[model samples]
Each structure stands twice: as structure tokens, then as C-alpha cells.
Target: MEWEAPALVLSATPYGEGSAIVHVLTGEYGLYHGLARGGSSRRGRPVWQTGNLVRARWSARLSEQLGGMTAETVHASGARLLDHPLPLAMLASLCALADGSLPEREPHPAIFQGLTSLLARISLDPQWAVDAAMPEIVRWELLLLSELGFGLDLGQCALGGGQDDLAWVSPRTGRAVSDARAGEWRARLLPLPAFVLHPEQTGTPGDWYDGLCLSGHFLRRDAFGQRHRPLPEARIRLADRIARLADVVPPDEATGENSPQPD
Candidate 1:
């Protein structure tokens, strides 16, 4: 059995002399692990990077076997992100989360398209790649949660049934709460990022920081925690890095106001 598709290289672990255990995400095939011959060599290394978009072909004697993968670089986006710290972190966390969380061999077309869109935007931006990808990564996590059956109900307030002025997300229920309804509980609820409420605008670095905190909570609790795993270290580092960049509280920090938000 064999298939060819546009794939996002999620990971490449050097396995033997010149081969790698490669994992890629595709719209049609979902996440697939394949053995890539010569993947670690100079000529091939650039093509298997974590965030590169590639045209990949995989074949095996049976549908269930680990296949041989050969890919041609369609966009060498991962290498370009290396020069920018935040974009690089975003790229790395994205690869790590998708690779670690998504179920193997189950088609998630929307997730694949969202990833392709973000990769295209950041890679094509010669100057503003960080700006281009910032909002998308946070939003992508929400999509990931939704696709995985943990979607946040941010359309209306869980407390008031109101559609406007949504202020906080109930970390307990993954639903939105308006400020008026939140009242005394405001301090406990997660901040519902303005950019998430309004996708037409670009968020300040600070708003983007809130966005990460909001999504990271449910991702850790529902996505990773349910599987008896913690959120990926790459994701933890991404939050910490973005916190410092935006000058905000890191999501997982222990503080006096509340207990440390544990996964």
C-alpha cells in the first residue's frame, strides 16, 4: 500500500547510520511514522525539519507496516524560523504537540489545513513572521482541542446565556463567562483573550500571552492529562518564552493569588 500527500514534518529522530524515524501529519492519512532512508544526511536533513511543508510519498508491503518515506521539500519553513526565537519556539511546540497528541492514522483535515495555513503565513513573511504566526498558534490549539472533543464554548456565557462581553473561560467547564456573571469568580477563571473573541484584529504581545494561557490550560487538562501524560516540555518552554517576551505571568507559575495551575 502507498500514498502521496502534502505533509508537515512533525519530527525526525535519527535512528541509524543515515536513516531517521520520521513522523509527518497529512490531511488524508493523519499522523504517520515512517523510516526515511538517508534522512539524516546533509542533502536530506533540511527536508525533514519539524515545520517544513513537504510533498511526501510513503509505501510499505502492508497498510499497517512502518513504511519507507521519501519527501521533496515544498517549503523549507523550519530552517527560516531558526533565526527568530519566538517563531522557532512556536514551530517547535506546534510540532511537538501535534506529534504527541493527535491519534495516529485518523484523518483530521481541518487541523492539517490550519497547520498548513500558519506555516505558509510565517514562512512567507520575510520580516513579520513572528507577527504572522503568533495569533494563529494560539487559535490552532483551540481548534486542536475542539477536534479532539474538548471544544471550548466561547460563543455565549455559561452563566448568563449572553452572547456579548465574554470575559473569562471557566477552566472547569471549557465555557465562556461574562464579566457581570463572573463577579467574585473573576480571579479564578481564565482570561478569554480579546483576539480570540475578535479574530479580525491582531493582538498585542500581551493579549497573545493571555491567549496561550487560556488554551494551554485545557490542552494540558483534557488533551494530555487524560492520556496520563503531561503537556510537552516544548509547549511549557513556549509559554515561558512568550511570557517573558510579553512581560506577563507564565501560565504554570506558582503565585500567591492562586494555587499553581497544574495540568
Candidate 2:
């Protein structure tokens, strides 16, 4: 069987003397692994870097077998961000999360689009690191949770019907809780930033941190926790960087009252 698709290189590792095993996320194929002959060679190395967008063709005698892939560069997203540390980190973290959390060969078109949009945003503006990158990254993390079936319901209170004053998310159920409903139990719920609940809001950095914390909670509890694996180190590091940048209390140290406030 043979097929071609637009793909994002997630990871590549040496296989034989000059060959590599490449993992990629595709718009149609989801996450896939294939053998890339000469992928370790100087000529092919640039195309295999994580976060590069490529046009890839995979061919195998049997549809279920790991196939051989031949790719041509479409957009060298990673190369463009090489000089920018924070955006580079964000890209690496995004690739790592998708590579780690997603099931192989299961199509997730939304995730593919989200990733493409994120890369496009960063690529268009060299100064995205200062302005829009972090918030977009946080938002993408939320979308990842949703695509994986661990989405939070932030429209109304999980306990009461009120939409106003919705401030926290129940760690156990991944649902939003109103400030009134969480009066006593607020100490235990994760902060649901207004921006996450309402994307139209231009959130502050603190709100971005809270949004990450809210999404990270379920990412840990529902995604990695169930697999008996830890959240990717890249993700943890990105969260820490965001915490510092936002100057907000880290999720581990945040309580209801101290959660980052919305702009």
C-alpha cells in the first residue's frame, strides 16, 4: 500500500548505518512511523528535524507494516525558529505532546490544523515570542485535551447552572465550577481562566498560566495518569517557563484565591 500526505516530523532516530526511523503527524494518517533510508545523511538530516513540515510518501507491501518513507521539505518550521529559544521550546513541546499522547494511525484533523496554525503564526512574525506565542501554545494544549476526549466544560458551572463567576474546574471530573458553587470546595479545583472559557477575552499572562494549569491538570490526571506515564518533560519545562514569564504562582503552589486573575 502507498499513500502521500502533508506531515509534520515529530521525531527521527537512527536505525541502520545511514537509515532512520521517522515519526510524523499527518492530517489524514495521524501519527505514523516509517523507515527513512539515508535519513541520517547530511542531505536528509534537515528534512527530518522535529517540527518541520514535509510532503511524505509511505509505501509498504502490507498496510499494517511499518513502511518506507521518502519526503521532500514543504516548510522548514524548525529551521526558522532555531534562533528563538522560547518559540523553539514551544514548538518542541508541542511536537513532543502530540508524539507522546496520540495513538498511532488515528486521524485527528483538528490537532493537525491547530499545529499548522501555530507554526504559521510563529513563522509570520519574528517577534511572536513576545506577543502571541505563549497564549497560542496554551490554547493549543487545551485543544489537544479536547481532541483526546479529555476536554473541560467551561461554558457553565458543573455544580450549578450559572455561567457567570465560573472560576474553577473540578480536578476529578474535568468540569467547570462557579465561584458560588465552589465556595468551600474551591481549594481543590483547578483555576479556569476566563480566556479559556471565552477566547474572545484578551487574557493577561497570569491568565495564560492559569489556563495551562487547568489544561495540565486533566492532561496529567486523564491522559498520562491513565497510561502510567508522566507528562512529557518538554511540557513540564514549558509550563515552568510560562509560570516565570507570567509571574504567577505555579500550579503546584496555586490555590483558589491565588490563582492568576484575568485581564
Candidate 3:
């Protein structure tokens, strides 16, 4: 079989002396791996880095076999993002998450769009990148959850008729729970930020950490289950950057609760 497609570099690992195994998220082929002949050579090295976009040609006799690929760089996202560690880390974390969890050869159009969108936003400007990217990242997280069959239902609370104040979410069912209905079980509930469910507050970052903690908790528990998998180092780095920013900026404004300052 032979095919050609546009792809985003997910990873590259040395195969032998001069060849490398390249993983790419292709538009038609989905997340697939192929042997990039002479990938470690000077000519191929520039096009094979993670985050570089490429046009790839793959050929293999059998559909199931590890194919051989000839790739040429179409776009290089790494250069623009090189100085911005937060956005770089975000991109790396996203790639790691998608690579580690998603099934190969399975198309995830929404997730793919989300990843590209985030990368573009990251390359824009450092001052406004985090503010612009956080909510979008949350949306991406929610999308991934939905794909894995663990989506959060952000509609009315399951327990209470009062829709005025739906504050927390049930991790078990991935839905909202009103403060009144929460009762004694509130302590166990994940604090789903008001902005997450409210359309009017889409860009607000109220309780962003809580949201991250909540999503990360459920993602690890529901998606990874019983596995000794570690959280991606890129994720750790992003979180640390956010934490550091919080020390200088007011916690509420920085967290996206209040209005964002101009980048």
C-alpha cells in the first residue's frame, strides 16, 4: 500500500545508526508510525523534529506492517515556539497525551483541530498566549474526555431544581451538582468552575487550577486506570509556569476569574 498525506510530527526515535522511527498524526492515516530512512542523517534531521509539519509518502506491502516513509517539511512550528517554554510545554504535553492514549489509525478530527489551534495560539505572542490558551486547553481536555466516553454533562444539576448556582461536578458521572444538593458530599466533589459550563464566561479562567486538577484526576483514573503511568513532564512544566506567574499576578485575575490584561 502507498499513500501521501500531511502530518504533524508526534515523535522520533533513533532506529539504528542513521535511520529513525517517526510517529506522525496524518490527516488521512491518523496517528501512525513509519521508518524514516536516513532520518538521523543531516538532510532528514531538520524535518523530523517533533512539532514540525510535513508532507509524507508511505509505502508498505502489507497494511499492518511498519511502513517506510519519505517526508519533507511543510511547516516548522518549533522555531517560533522555541523561546516560549510554557507554550512549548503545552504542545509537548498535548502530543504526549495524544500519542500515549489515542489508538493508532483512528481518526480524531476534533482533537487534531484542537492541537493545531493551540499550537497556533502559542506561537502568536507570549504576553497573551497563556491567557488565550488556557480556556482553549480546557476545551481540548473536555474533548479528549468526551472521546474516551467520560464527557462531563454541564447542563442542569442532577439533584437540584435551582439552576442559579451550579458550582461543583460529580467526578463519578461527569456532571454538575448544585451547592444546595451537594450537602455533605460536597467535599468529595470536583469543583467545576462556573466559567466552564457558562457560555457567557467562555474565556474566564476562574478556578483554572481546580479545573485542571479535576480533569487530570478523572483523566488519569478513568482513562489510564490501574496503570503506573506518570503524568507527562511537559504537563508538569506547564503547571509550574502557571504557578510561577500566579505569584506575581493577582491570583484571581491570573486564574482567569477576572478580566485579562492586554498582552
Best by lDDT: 1
Report the C-alpha lDDT of model 3 over 10-123, residue by residue, as the tens digit.
888888988999888875667888999899888778888787778888899999999998898887777678887777777787777777666788888877777766666676
Model 1, span 1-263: residue lDDT tens: 99999999999999899999999999999999999999998887999988999999999999989999999999998887677777777778888889988999999999999988887777667356566466778889999999999999999999889998898988788889998899888878888877887877778878878888888888887787788777888888888877787887775521111323424
Model 3: lDDT to the true structure: 0.71
Query: What's the candidate order when arranged by decreasing lDDT?
Result: 1, 2, 3
**In TM-score terms, which candidate is top?**
1
Model 2 per-residue lDDT tens digits across residues 1-263: 98899999998999889899999999998999999999999988999988888999999999999999999999898888888877877888889889888899999999999998887677657586556676677788888888888887777888878889988888777778888888878777777777776666757778877877877777776666677777778777777777888886567522112333322
User: TM-score order of candidates, best first?
Assistant: 1, 2, 3
How many clashes in each candidate?
0, 0, 1
Candidate 2, residue 38: the lDDT equals 95
TM-score of 3: 0.84
Alpha carbon lDDT of each predicted model: 0.84, 0.81, 0.71
Q: List runs of model 2 lying over 4 Å from the truth.
A: 253-263
- Each candidate's root-mean-square deviation in Å? 2.7, 4.2, 6.7
Could you tell me the TM-score of candidate 1? 0.93
